[model samples]
Target: MTDALERALASLDVRAGSTRRHTLPAGGDIVLPAGSTTLVYLLSGEITGDLALGSGCEVDAPTGDGRPVSGRRTLLAGDAAMSLGCRRLVLSSQSGAEVIVVTAEITPSEIVASLPGTVLVTGFARLEPAAAALAGNLGPRPDGLACERPGDTVVCRSMIRSVLLSAVRAWASTGAWPAPIADPFLARVAAAVEADPGHDWTIDHLASLAAMSRTVFVERFRDAMGRSPAGYVTEVRIREAQRRLDAGASVSEVSRALGYASDEGFRRAFRRHTGIAPSAWRARALTA
Candidate 1:
């Protein structure tokens, strides 16, 4: 995985985007806004951070983990889960630690499911996501690793997503808790959703076409994908939005194409899920 990191990073077009790297002194605190997803990798030294995921929840090292107070280590060397959108976030580092905090300009599920490994560790509030999914964990490259680059710090963010999607697919075949996309009905539904991103679809309608009772369909959908029917639908919408925007659709046009009742609603939802406004993201992600 380490060896692959460099190459993977090189392949990513992040150069078109922007990232911030910091050498945080111990006791440093950084504030992050609501509805943003970040990937913090401990390149060197230990660091502990706090998270506020809204809904009156907080992720702190001292009081949350319920570990032995005396021997508590605030931060260890590792990666943080992809934080889901929430109210705010706080991060602290040891006296002299090096870390790469990649504030992703993408959606939560889009980036999380696209990580390198199926099994990923998250932050305290679970605001972050885990990469370790039960997927192909199958495919052509079980040993594929994150990409690396020519710099002091290595950040193969794009490569990680590719590897994870592959891993998740592999594990699905083995019946990992939530199986991968192996069910034919589910596959058909996926195809249908992708084929008609503008369709005003419903779960009941999908269930009928899939030839299963609504209850059965819901259960199977969750069992196979680890997300509710609506959740998956939202995912499809987000992906479709990306495609349309990349193809040069205005925000309103993209929203209308996705059957969104209002462009404002689409914008809000897009920011909540992707951590950036549609226009800003599109400008950076798909420039000719």
Candidate 2:
């Protein structure tokens, strides 16, 4: 499932190479930002853990935020149903299982214009249909890498996109975006965020750009994607840093591009989220 979902994102325009795939021991908790939606495909075993809007925000998996997302006709056969405000999403891994996840902020502006559809709006978020569908199909890895299967990655990604395009058409025809996928305000904010990751960003600047009160922006941002404006910016910065790192940018150069207070600050945030120092991370990406 994880592989399928990752492939879905891989096929899309938003950071195909940016998707992070990792393996964790059972019962281990991993924190991910809500700046993007996640599609988890349980691999080698099933991972039964709480799905949350950030580490602390729990929306009741069975009946999230006064909404129910299970056993619905349009919802996938094995899919989950819940109100998905764009909070920085987090998932805990169950014992003896590895999960595949694709976390990203692929707004409608990034996709809707390209693919005309019902355009389900969510808070300040927009889940590009292709990416969302790929997230949905994170299982049955494709065929490419020489691991357990041949062309696993390639085949899985191709099939995942096929499913994603199909699901978008089906859901858009039904005329309503899913609860947790995305909403209106979220969409607008995504447009803004995608416009400039290099902005000298601040909560106030984001609040103004989002056209909301500071408190409102902060709360809504937290509720929708799980991270504060600053937090979301940090995530975006890291993504940018990864690109630079992959392209052979020095850590200090990346810090300047992402508007970090300093290179040290970027290093701290990068390590905290990815469990590796930036210098080391750059080496890995470049080497890989």
Candidate 3:
């Protein structure tokens, strides 16, 4: 089976949106709200903070050298933090600090959900040298000037994208988070489903692909993936449907491509998963 991380990185898509810089005076505190693609990097000085994560959110920090000691911890220069969902990060600077906050949108949004909701990388420069170099290359663009220049924006976004990828890679290498599908057998099944979501992936077919009996496959798949095989297939299909829809595919076309028996069936499944119909979701995504 292909390495899980490699597969995830391959499917990952990120688009940089807005970038902002903040300078906090000594003894000042700031509340930063985090979204699915938010990243905060400390440029200088130190700050202490606590993360308030919402339901279904998770936090991962270093357990040995850089771990947060309690509910609040301090981050030094070159440190970074990210949250995959809605969160409130309260930061306080003792001797002042400079930070850059960036927002991006990631596709295959499920990848974000699979990752830890909160990631604190203390001493990030040491852990991810190349990413750190990219961050350093940004220097200090006065008053967010980079965002104003189209060419500079492109270069900045590219560097930020690399930083995000490197951060994920560093965290994943630590094995602090669970792989989406840990079992080799189950991973094979998942790879096949993802590679061809339109395939008719019945339990029997999936089991055969995994070289296991249906019963064993079902049990193990649930254990590893936290959902039944059928549910997983539905999830994969819906995610692909979203991607296709975002790419300007019509609802009917998506339904057909994903092997739905009828447009109505696809519509129902899409609404159940996203709480929005395919057409509406496409419109919103396109406009956004």
Candidate 4:
């Protein structure tokens, strides 16, 4: 499920990356001007803060908000509007604290659309024990090691993806994920598509799987997923192709495995979805 969410986000062009670590001294305040969407993960200590997003948006953390912030991890995810509005964002803590901020190069609306009802939109959530440990392990890593070398880029992406996936999964476990996955029919059909993107899927077949007529199924699916069934299937396939290519699979192999009639056919579809040929995308992805 996390993989599906990650792939969907990739197809939607939302790139997540770490920015910098911030430390707030005791009784200190840090004001930030408006900017992109940001995720702040508390690494240590306690803090309380408030934010004003332009005129109508405001986020408030009560005084001594993070007092006794032990064991579990505290996280705040929101756009610059909410975190740093037209005026500015202010952070203060009775005791000092350490936090890592990750900014995604997309607006709050885009993040909401891409992630649906996930925590990324709600702007706040707590990590469970295991998820907290995983996040803590990643908090100290350096940001933006240039991707000039394929190996280094892969490592950087892996780390970034791991943290993002952890965040998504934690929210998912809290039952805050979108309603589609909770629907029995949609869940079953989505599982089928993700499990085997190479499978030849038709509207009729998918409707049958969901025990619905074609007309009804198409309408329901689009309503729930925001895409036609066929379009969703194509997206999953492209994402699968991307994963395989990242793992060093050749174009021919990927094309055949994805059930494309020819390598050229796969190339064209890949370019349509990703804006580049498979070979070109692979080169850039390996070095981007």
* Candidate with best TM-score: 3
Any runs in candidate 2 off by more than 4 Å, and if so which? 1-183
TM-score, cand. 1 vs. native: 0.44
Top candidate when judged by lDDT against the true structure: 3
Q: Model 3 Cα displacement at 257 (Å)?
A: 13
Q: For candidate 3, which ten residues in a row score worst on lDDT?
A: 53-62
lDDT of every predicted structure (CA atoms)? 0.51, 0.47, 0.73, 0.57
Model 4 stretches with alpha carbons more than 4 Å out: 1-18, 31-35, 51-90, 104-161, 178-187, 284-288
Show where candidate 3 strays beyond 4 Å. 34-36, 52-70, 137-150, 177-202, 209-216, 230-288
TM agreement with the true structure for every prediction: 0.44, 0.41, 0.65, 0.61
lDDT of 2 by residue, 1-288 (tens): 222222222323222223334466766655544444443333344333343322222122222222222211121122321112244334455555444444322333212232221111121012234444455445434442334566655655454434334333333333222223265666566556645777877777778767888999899889887667777766666666666776798999988887778889889987886667989877755543
Better of 1 and 4 by TM-score: 4
Q: What lDDT would candidate 4 get against the real structure?
A: 0.57
- The residue ranges of model 1 lying beyond 4 angstroms of the native Cα positions read 1-107, 111-114, 117-180, 286-288
A best-first ranking of the candidates according to their lDDT comes to: 3, 4, 1, 2
Tell me the tens digit of each residue's lDDT in model 4 across 223-254: 88888999888877888898788667889999
Model 3 agreement with the true structure over 1-288: per-residue lDDT tens digits: 135455455435677777767788999876666555677788898888765432222223344222223366677898887656566667899999988777777764455665655677777777777787777656457554433554776677778888888777666655544355557888889889988999998999999999999999999988888889999999888877877777788999999999999999999998897776888888865653
TM-score-based ranking, best first?
Answer: 3, 4, 1, 2
